[model samples]
Structures are given as structure tokens and as C-alpha cells.
Target: MTSLILLSGWGCDARIWRPLAPHWPHGLEVKAPDWPGYAGRPSLADPTSLTDLADAMAEDLPADAVWVGWSLGGLLAGALLDHLPAPRALVLLGIGEHFVHPQGVSDTALADFQRALRRSPDIAREHFLRRQLAGEPDPTGSRRALRELLGTALPAPFATLDAGLEHLAHLDIHHCLSAASCPVQRIAGADDPLLAPEVIARADQRIENAGHCPMLSQPQRLATRLASVATAPDAKRPESTS
Candidate 1:
């Protein structure tokens, strides 16, 4: 049986995947590990490159696990394509080759948030979490659920936040996607203001009316979409669906 590795985005712990737990499609073992330094996990030793981060996350993963990553996690999955023991497939969510986007969060916007975070990690974490939920159909309920889920688990050290931001600033796998050894699938929330529609439409699958954290906003749809990726062929072919 193939296993699935679920990687979380920046400022989020593996706990963020809980909503999708009941929605995982059949026939796969799913594992979500706290990235180095987030959710109280220890930071990777001398992690000088994206490859280093990938290695640290891979230590416990099976050689053939399908990697499903969200936002910053998506970028990490791309970096691991060569370093990992060769995954069965890769699924990228709410992100593409780079975190900097035209229709999404810009460098200036992120820089401003980073500056605020440097001042107070707690304040920044909540602020960022709320900011990430843009385009949610029900702001009241979604915000409530998101806040409860994030309750007291964040405000992680600045160093851990910086580690992830470092990759967002420098990592670019657009040139490397062609060389990926496994099947690649991209999925994003259709209403995600953080992701450009055209950019996400390029994905193999997409969840409708959802935002960056589709797991929180549309768990069932996201789960079904991921099931599609898990069983997909190992190829670069892109599918346009909403």
C-alpha cells in the first residue's frame, strides 16, 4: 500500500491536517509530520539549503510515500524530488514554483508581515492566520474554527518562521519541475486570493470556493481532489478542473 505524506504551510503545525483526516480517500496510509521547528519540533541541524530541510522531513517517511504539500509545504516537496528516495507522486497545494505571486501575496506584503512578526511572534501568527483565509465563503464560522484549531499551538520562535521564509525568498523549482522523477499534481482553492486563478487553473485539480487552507474551508472537496492525485499517473500532464 502507498503512503501519503502531508506537509503543512508556514506558521502552521501538522495539526492543521485534522479536518481532512476523515476525508482521505481509500487505499493509502497518510502521515503528517511537524516540519523542523514548527509545532514545537526541533529545528534541523545546520540546515543550509532547501535540500537540508527536505532531508530532515524525509527521515521518517517511506521511500514511496506520495508527498502532499500546501503552500510553503508545496515548495518543500519540490525541493525533495531529487533528495528523497523517490516518492510515488507529488501533490502541490495553493502554491506553484515560487511563493511570490502577481495575483497573490507580494514580497512587500510578506516583508511587512515579517517585520511585524519580529516584534511579536504571537501577534504575527494570529494575524497571518487570519490573513491566509481570504475569500472564505463564511468568514464568521471559518474564522472561529480556524482560531480554535490554532489555539495556543503557534507563536513559534522567530528562527523557525525565518527558516521557512528563507526558502520562500530563494527557492525556485520552475526549472526543475521538468526533471521531477515522479508524477506531479497541483491543486489550489479556486477562491484563494493568495493564488492567481490562471496559475491555479494550471493545476491537475482544484477545489471550488475554497481558499489557501482548503482543508479548513472545504475538507471534503480537497480530500476528494487529493484522492485523484494519489491515484494519478506519474506524468507532468496538467488537468484543468474546478
Candidate 2:
């Protein structure tokens, strides 16, 4: 059976994809695995790098699967394209090769949030979550509900969170996009404040009226899109301008 692996982003657990579980397409096996340090997993090893972190997550994923990733999860999936034995394709939601964007989340703003996370993880996490949904029509309500679904941004050993931030700050998958041997499909929330609308529109597909976290705002709609992604022929990868 073709496996459909759903990878969650930073500050989130496998349960973040729970809302879309019942709506997945029939026949394909679906699984959502927690990142190295989230959910109930213990702290990531010392000096955690993106390579090492993706390696750790590799164990839980299938060698050949249609991987659907959100935010940080999308980045992880991109990094692993070279590692998977038979990666079918990749569907990135609310993320791209580079996290820092001038029209999106500025480097300075993200740096400030990273520093705040180091000094006060809880407060910074809450603020970060709020910002994720700021583009939604109902930011207050979405934040309140999504806050519970995603759980805490910080698990044990705050360094893992720091390391995750480091990955976001530095790691760019510009190389991976061109090197990828498998098909790639990019999807994003129409109202995501974190990522520019132009970026999302450039994707192979896009969701409407959703914020950075589409699974929570429009789970059914997102699920339908994933179904289409699964059934469609291999999507063409965009040529790199670099």
C-alpha cells in the first residue's frame, strides 16, 4: 500500500494532524509521526543539527511514501529527499526552501522571536502561535483553538527548541529543490501571514481562507487537497533560477 506520511512542524506533535485523519483518501495508509523532541519523545541529543534531526526522524517514515509536511516539517521533508530510498513525492504546506523572507517573516523579526524563546519560552511560544494565525479572519478564535491542538512549543531541554530555531534561521533547501529526483507539490494557506501570498500562489496548489496552520482552520479542505495530490500524476518540479 502507498503510505501517506504527515509530518508536523516545530512546537507541534503528531496530534496536530489529527483533525485531518478522518478525511484522508481511502486505500492509502496514513501516519503522522512526532518530530525528534516533540510529543512524548525525550530531548534530542546534544549539538542537534538539522541533518542529525532528519536522520532521527527517518526511522519513523517509509522509504517510499507521499510526504505531506507543514512549516518546519516541510523543511525536514525537503532535507530528507536525498535520504529516502524511494520517496514518491513531497507536498509542502506553509513553507519553502527559505524561511526568512522580506515579504514574509523578516529575519530581524524571527531573530527577535528566537531570542525571546531563549529568554522566555512559554511567552514567546504563545506569541509565535498567535502570529501564525494573524492572517486568518478570526485570529483570536483560531489562536485559542489551535493553541490547544498543537500543545506546547517547548518540550524538555529548551536547547532542542533553540536548535530548531537555528535550523529555521540557517538551513535553506535551495539545493534540494533542484537535486530532488521525485515530484514536488507546494501548498499553502491563502491568508497565511507568515508566508507571502505570492510564495503560496507559486506553489503547485494553495488553500483558501486559511492561515499558516490549515489543518486546524480548514481541515476538510486541506484533506481534500491531499487526496488530489495523492491521485494526480507526478507533479513537475519548478526550475531553479539560481
Candidate 3:
């Protein structure tokens, strides 16, 4: 059985994965650890530093587990490949080569979000959550499901949330993914508003009728996609995209 490490995106904690838990394939060892400053975890001195983030997590992250990261989490996971022992495989969910892109979130929009985060963290988080469901076929249903799965878990610290946005603004790991020694795979939501159309089209698999939070809207489909990755030939490589 393959060991799986699940990483959630900004504004969310490990609890966001609760929806996928029931649908997760059998015989897989799954671990979902909150990022620093989340779920009572201490904040990094410099949360913006990928090196700091990677080093902070190095000790606990098993070197052999397959890592699946979503959104901002995907960027952090990609950065880990440069600092830690490569995992058996690295899976990126609803992530593009760059978080801030001409085809996706713009620099100005990101800066606006940073300002919003400072003004009202609660509203900012609510807005972010709603945005994630924008492209889903049934966004209301997706939002309701997400709310249920996330329950009442507290959001991460303001500093951590801000730092995550900083990463989204600057990090570009297309090079990292292309250079990784381990197999790299991508899974995208067919209607993901946060990802570029070309990026979604290039993914190893795309969950239909879903948006950015496929794990909430289509957990079973997402789980099936992951199971396929676990069973794929080790020699399989990521497809090149324009």
C-alpha cells in the first residue's frame, strides 16, 4: 500500500480533507498534517521562505510517501522537492505552473486580496471560499458540502494566511516540477476558475463538474484519480504543456 501525504491550500486546514476521507481508496496510508501556524501549529519565523517552510516540515514528512498538494499547498510541495529527499511521487491538484498568471489570478488581484486579508480576515476567508466554487456545475451544493466537511475548524493565523498569499504572488515552480527526480503528476478540476484552461487540459486527470475544490465537490472522482496515479508505472512522466 502506498503512503499518501495530503496538503491543503490557503484559508483551509487539514480538516478540509475530511470529505475525501470516506471516499479514499482502500489499502492506502493517508496523513494530513496542518501547515505551520495552522491547527495550533506554531508559525514559522519567515513563512514566506520556501526553505524555511520545507526545513520546518522535513523531520515529520516521510521521504517515501506520495505527496498530493492542492493550490498554495502544491507550490509548497513543489518547493520541497528542491530541499528534501524526493518523494515516491508528487501530485499537484488544481495548481498551475505559477499561481499568479496572466491566465489566472493577476498581480493586482492578489495584492487586493492581501489588503482584504488585513481589513477583515473573516470576510476575506469567506470570499475566498466562495471564489473556489465559482466554476463548479453546482456551486451552491459544493459550498454546502465544503462547509459540512470543514465543520468549525478555526482558520490559520493571519500571518500564515498572509504569507501564503505572498507565496501565491511570487512562487513559480514549473521548473521545479520539470526537474524533479521523482515522477510528477497533475490533477485539475475541469471547471477550475483558479487554473488556466491549458493547465487543466494538460493534467493527468480532470474531475468533471468540479471547480477548484474538487475534493469537496467530487471526492470520489478525485480519489479515483489519485488511485490511478498510485498504480501507474513509476516511469510515467508528466506531459509537457505550453
Top model number, TM-score: 3
Highest lDDT against the true fold, candidate: 3
The 10-residue segment of model 2 with minimum total lDDT is: 148-157
CA-only RMSD, every prediction: 3.2, 1.8, 1.9
Better of 2 and 3 by lDDT: 3
Point out where model 3 deviates above 4 Å: 151-154, 233-242
Per-residue lDDT value at 104 in model 3: 74
Residues 1-242 of candidate 3 have per-residue lDDT tens digits of 66788999998888888877887777877888889998889999988877888878986567778888999999999888888998888898999667987677779988999999899888888888899889988889888877876654557788899999988999988778778888888889999998878778877778888889888778888887776666662534655554
TM-score of each: 0.90, 0.92, 0.93
Clashing pairs in 1: none
Write model 2 residue lDDT over 39-139, tens digit each, in one string.
66865675256557666777776767788888988887887776665477788889988788989988999899899998998988778777888877688
Q: Total clashing residue pairs per candidate?
A: 0, 0, 0
